[model samples]
Target: MIYLDHNATTPVDPRVVEVMLPLFTDQFANPASKHGPGREVTRIVERARREVATLAGARARDVVFTSGATEAANLAIGGALAAAGPDRPRVLVGATEHPAVLGAADAAAAAAAGPGTRAERIAVHPDGTIDVDDLRRLLGPDVALVAVMAANNETGAVNDLRPLVEPVHSAGALLFSDVTQALGRIPVSLERTGVDVAVASAHKLYGPKGVGALVASGDAWARIAPRAHGGGQERGRRAGTLNTAGIAGFGAAARIAAASMTDDGRRQRTLVAQLTELLVGQLGRGAVELNGPVRARLPNTVNLRFVGAGADDVQACLPQVAVSAGSACSGGGDVPSHVLLAMGRTAAEARESLRFSLGRATTPEEIRTAADQVARAVQRVRSLTQSTPIQDEVRDDNRARTARPAGTPA
Candidate 1:
């Protein structure tokens, strides 16, 4: 099968596996223990922390390991709200944020014991980036946190976070970013961007799954209370036994990504362009519409709407080529993409969209083959549907006027 769904998860690099194997067999002691074996494992965990921190543009002491980005997001959002108390009982999250962030904010607001916190959504532009004006309008002293991701997982649209720092800080709120999709695919400098708290998953960057990090500034940590209480691990911020093997693999992945990210990004960007051009060329421009920004996006990702063709039908036609209709976390639901809906797409338009995310190992040859297969699948699906030619044209025109400007080519 031709796998084009790297956004869901990536294959672990062999080098990362090599780094992890030794830990599981030879050095499996708990990092929290005080024995010599435990001390040795602690060193390994610390080394991984530094590597992850370096990639995230954060200090080593600021990184806290978690099971994955979802857990990290919960810790960040829940902990922040818990610490802020009832006086600052509001969180402003991006409308297109991952379900983890959105759900965390909602759960925090609905907490039974604490003073009620409200979770509001900041609107997004048509191209999927956060609307800073809307964010500014929503900011207030009562707002405790603002969540705007660095890059969108479905559309690959990037946000210019520097423009938001001043406004968020002025309102006495911390800026939190979920960089799970942006960490290795694009440059992410949490400290440089003034993002107080950021979360990333190792699996997104070719490391083992079940390992991720939450990097926060000193002040942000001071405002965050511990969610999990146990043996007082992770500087007392998170409590659990560390995954030594996964942490080592995460470090190896970060080290590799740091050295090759630029080259990898450049190569993947070319492949994505090639694939998109091939699809548009074969399917005709009107039949295909770009779902995200034409620029200021992740190099390895693209989302497109095949006009008049349902994404589920297209996928069913091309079983050999793996792609996603929306966020993998959505569990293959028939529901329309909330990200697209928030960006002004109709339910039908959202269902017609498909996401193609490339990986470091994706090649020009695979791009050509996948493009041919997808084109055939789209044509077959369109023909099978009973819509008339005039209806298709009208739908295509409406999509162009709403989703993309009239002059722009798909």
Candidate 2:
């Protein structure tokens, strides 16, 4: 299959795998152990921490490894809320945030409720960009944290976070960003942006899954409480045995991403543009609507809505191409995309949308083939709808059967 769902997850890079192989075999000793083998393993883990910190533009000391972005996000939100005392109990989250952020914010609020503690959702513009003005209106001294993503997983919309730093800091609130989709695709400097807390998964950047990091500033860490307790691992912020192999791969991926992101992004942007143009050209501009900003988006991502065609049905018709109607984390539900709905799309329009995310491994030939196949599938589905509305046909058949006399045949 032609994979175009890099926003969901990427195939592990072979170079990253090569670096991790030795750790799983000869160097399998636990980092926490106090032996010669353990000291060597501990050294490797610290090196990986530095590599990850470099990518995130954070200090090595502030990097805390976790299972993945989901867990990192939970620890960041929950820990911050827990430490925020009863005076500052409000948490503001973006409307188009990933499920991890939304769910974590809800759980954190529920777990840390006081008299007025709650989680509020910030709104987004029609172009899928966060509404900074709306966020300013929502900010207050009582707000402890603001959760916004650096880039949207579905639409690839990039947020201008610089404007938010002043407002959030002035209100005595911390800025937390979920940078899972933005880390490798774009230049995200947590230190430069003054982002207090940021989370990213290695799998999204061509590393192994089950490994990620929470990069928090010195002040941010001071405001967070430990979520897990055990052997005092991760400096007591996250308590668990480190996955040496996965962490090694994650560091390698970060190093590679740092070196090659410029070239990879340029090439992927060309491919994505070609694929998008091919579809819109074949289907006509009116029939296909772009969901996010034309610019200021990830070079490898695109979300499009095919008018009069259900995204599920279109996806079903194109079995050879791997794409998503929405986020993989949302599960296989018939519900409309919350991201699109929050961006002013109706439920029907949201159902008609699909996201195609390219990667470094994606080829021009694959783009050509995927475009042709997807365009044909959309046309076929639209034709079927025109010829016989499936719902109407089913209803008509039911009425005819009900009206027929029972057991009329002799």
Candidate 3:
């Protein structure tokens, strides 16, 4: 199978696995222990911390390790709201945010103590990028946090977060970003971008699953309360025994990404363009419409709308190509993509959209094969749906019904 779903998760790099192997067997001591082995393990963890921090443009002390981006998002949103107290009970999140961020904001708003406390969605442009004007209009002193992701998972829309920093800070609210999709695929410096709190997962960057970090500034960290409490790990921002092996692997992955990201992005962007051009050449430009922004998009990602073909039906027709109808978190469900809908697409149009995210290992040959397969699958689905006599009959009946006067007999 040709895997094109790197936005969902990436295969763990062998080098990262190589670094993690010894931690599970020979160096299996708790970092919290006072013994020599434990102290040595602690050093290893600290080194990994520094590596991840460097990639994120954050201080090592500011990184809080978590189980994954979901947990980290919850911790950051919940902690930010908690620290702000009841006075600042409102949360403003981007309309196209990940489920984790939306859910965390919803939960916080639901649990809030005041009457007017709630979570509101900031609007997005038709290209799926956050509307800075809409965000500025929504900002207020009552808003405790603003969550605008660095890049959208489904549409690969990259937001210019620097445009939002001043407005958000002026309103006395913290700016949090879910950078899970952008961290390794693009250059992201939270400190330079003025993002107060950001969440990222290792699995998105060729590291092991179940390891992510909440990178925050010193001020942002002070505003966040610990969600888990027991061992006072992660400098009291998070509490639990560290996943030593996974942490080591995460560090190695970061180091590798920092070194090779430029080359990887350049290569993947070319391949993605090749894939798009091939599909459009075969399917025709009208039949295949690009869903995300033509510019300011992720180098390895593209979302396309196969006109007149349901995404699910097309996927069913192409069993070998591993593409996604939407975010993996919401995949396998009948619901249309919220991200696409937020970008001014109708429910049917959203249902017709599919996301193609490439990875470091994707090749030109694979791209060609996948594009040919996708073109065939889309054609098959469209023909099956548009040529059926039953569908024609249904369309005729619908047109007749509409033409008839209201309340008239059938």
lDDT, candidate 2, 82-123, per-residue tens: 899898999999999999999999999999868888999999
Give the alpha-carbon lDDT of every model.
0.91, 0.93, 0.91
Best model per lDDT: 2
**Please, what are the lDDT tens digits per residue for candidate 1 over residues 253-284?**
99999999999999989999999999999999
Q: TM-score for candidate 2, please give it.
A: 0.94
lDDT of 3 at 134: 94
Residue-level lDDT of model 3, residues 85-134, one tens digit each, is 88898999999999989998999778766767889999999999999999
Instruction: Name the weakest run of 10 consecutive residues (lDDT summed) in model 2.
Output: 389-398
Listed in order, each prediction's TM-score against the native is: 0.93, 0.94, 0.93
Q: Which residue pairs collide, candidate 1?
A: none
Ranking by TM-score: 2, 3, 1
lDDT agreement of model 1 with the native: 0.91
C-alpha RMSD of each candidate structure in angstroms: 7.9, 6.5, 8.6
Alpha carbon deviation, residue 1, candidate 2 (Å): 0.7
